[model samples]
Target: MKIHLSYGKDGLDVEIPERNLAGVLSFGASTPLAHPEEAIARSLQEPIGSLPLGELATKAKSACIVVCDITRPVPNKQLLPPMLRTLEESGIARNKITILVATGLHRPSTAAELDLILGQSMVSKYRVVDHHASVPGEQSLLGETKRKTPVYIDKRYLEAELKITVGFIEPHLMAGFSGGRKMVAIGCAGEETIKTLHSPRVLDDERCREGSIDENPLHDELMEISRMAGHDFVLDVSLDANRNITGVYAGHPQEAHAVGVEAVRRSVRATLKEPADIVVTTSAGFPLDLTYYQSIKGMTAALPVLKKGGMLILAAECSEGLGSERFTAMATRFGTATEFDEWIHQHPVDIDQWQLQECLKAVRQGEVVVVASGIRPEHRDKLFVRTAASVEEAVAQGLQKFGSQTTIAVIPKGPYTLVEVSRTSA
Candidate 1:
């Protein structure tokens, strides 16, 4: 059987033996809006649980719009224009309106990348700034949550008379779902705040996994942080597997995000009768698969459909190699996931340790093999997990390890498409 997997800019096709194939899991195909930009404009005018964006903008002098960095495939070019136009037309000065890239703890987006993120036309016209989590002076303390998680948001966002965030709704490994509160709580949070949110205390909770919302502690914490930061309005969209806007939600943060999440849950959830003995997954390509740190999401997202001791293979471009300096150092330092977990428990949460922490979850569950061509030769062996040269080679190794009886499942879209075992079949 020939299966095409989402990898890098151009996808990859590999031949999987028909006898071993369980199924290719993917999100339901959603039709793209016939007039997406017009749909976005209408969503702003007729929003849920709040006044229209234009009306809201009229009241505030300065507005701050937070957006996800390059890792997420948010249609920023489409989402930004209509909203920015509304703010400017409603009396907010062009200079007073700041588009803050919520980078979290990731590296700042370069000038060239900014052009790619928000088109050169928008970049030159608007006040665009990347949130620097490590810079202390850039953040302002917003007090603490009920869980005592410190809330430190970007000063530019907190100081703004009107706070807004634009993101797409998708299943998130830690926050239950991405978009809404996340664009501010984590994206615009300071380093200390980012560390606490990613620390084991929050993530170790069983409810923190994907597709969980109501009971997710991390989700609740993020909402609290967003509230303290005065998250006024949100404009979030739901995208199909092809990255086309399927649904546009604009209004009060929690209310509109809930609407978008419901739509996404219906579209992205996929299921199998039983756990697969071997699973093949990807980091959903390009911007997401650019680094190994981001690639870990592919592994964790497939865990629900994979047998506890199954051989799991991940294919990521990792064009930038291992990741940030701190993540690369931590990844190479510990020889095994067990050792790494032990050390992290005893020490303070270091920068970029959270990605490795999530990686440890996958490592503890089963054997993992990473197929990434961009990694340097020396760095391959140093990773906590094994590395393979290609997806075909990784599959061959898995078949050898798990034998002919082993069931193989493939998740071509990886983390973007949520997979789970059917309760009745189990």
Candidate 2:
């Protein structure tokens, strides 16, 4: 059986023996938008739970548009032009409008990357800046939320009379879903603010799981932070497996994001008959799998459908290496997953520790084998996981360890699709 898994830009294909293969899991394909530009324009013209974007922009002297950084697969090129036109038609000058890249704690986008994210023409005409979380002076404190989370956002974003956020809606590891309040709460927030929200105590909550929102403390805290930051109009888009825009939610941040989440739920949710002994998955391909830190999402997504003591083979490009020094340090400091959990129990204030902890949670579920061309073999050891030269080699080792009859599953799209094993199977 030949199966193609989402790898770098082109994708990677592997041939598995028919007798060894169990099933290939993925999200149900959704209908792509026939006219993305027209849909975006229409959404802006008739926004939900609020007045149209043009009407809202009328009284504002200056506007700030926040967008996701390079790590996300948001169709900014398709969404931004029409949004800018709407603001322009409402009397807001292009010079007065600033496009802020909500980078969170991630690195700033490069010139070429920014051109791809916002288009070369838009970059030259409008002011496009990256949010700097490490710089203290660039952020302003907006007081604390009810959960006592300190809210510090970019001062320039706060200075704008009107704030608008654009993002792609998808299942997130920590926040249940990504979009709406998250663009500001995490994207434009200062380092301290991000640290507070990503703290171990907050992430340890049961409701913080994927696809959950109502009682999710992380989502609730972000909502509170967004409310304190003041009213923000949002434009959230949902894409199909092919990365084409399938749904667009515009207007009030919270309400519109809810609409997008429902659309995403319908597209991503899948049920598996049983857990697999060996699962092979990818980190959702290029851009997303650019670094090891981001690649962890694919492992977490595959964990639910993997049986205990099973083998998990992850194919990630990780072209940027470990991505975070703090994360790498955390992994190296603790020898095993248990030791890492012990350290977190004793001290939970460290930044980026939650990500390492989350990675460890998936690691504890099964043995992990990585096939990363970008990560060095020596560095792979520090991650406390075995390394393989290719996906075929990893699967061959799994078969040898678990025997040929072991059920095997493949998640080609990885984190892009959620797998839920049936209760009867458990």
Which candidate wins on lDDT? 1
Q: How well does candidate 1 score on lDDT at residue 340?
A: 85
Question: By summed lDDT, which 10 consecutive residues of candidate 2 come out lowest?
Answer: 327-336
Per-residue lDDT of 262-291 in model 2, one digit per residue for the tens?
889889988778898899998999888998
Give RMSD to native, each candidate: 1.0, 1.5
Q: Write the per-residue lDDT of candidate 1 for residues 1-426, one digit (tens) a residue.
A: 999999888988878888999989999878889999999999999998999999999999999999888989899999999999999999999999999999999999999888888999999999999999999999999799999888888999988999999999999998888999999999999999989999988778889998889889999999888888898899999998889999999999999999999999989999988999889999999889999999999999999988988888999989999998888888899888888888988999887888888888888888999999888899998889999988889889888888988799999999999788986444
The residue pairs that clash in candidate 1, if any, are none
Model 2 bad stretches (over 4 Å): none
Q: Can you give the TM-score per candidate against the true fold? A: 0.98, 0.96
Off by over 4 Å in 1: 424-426
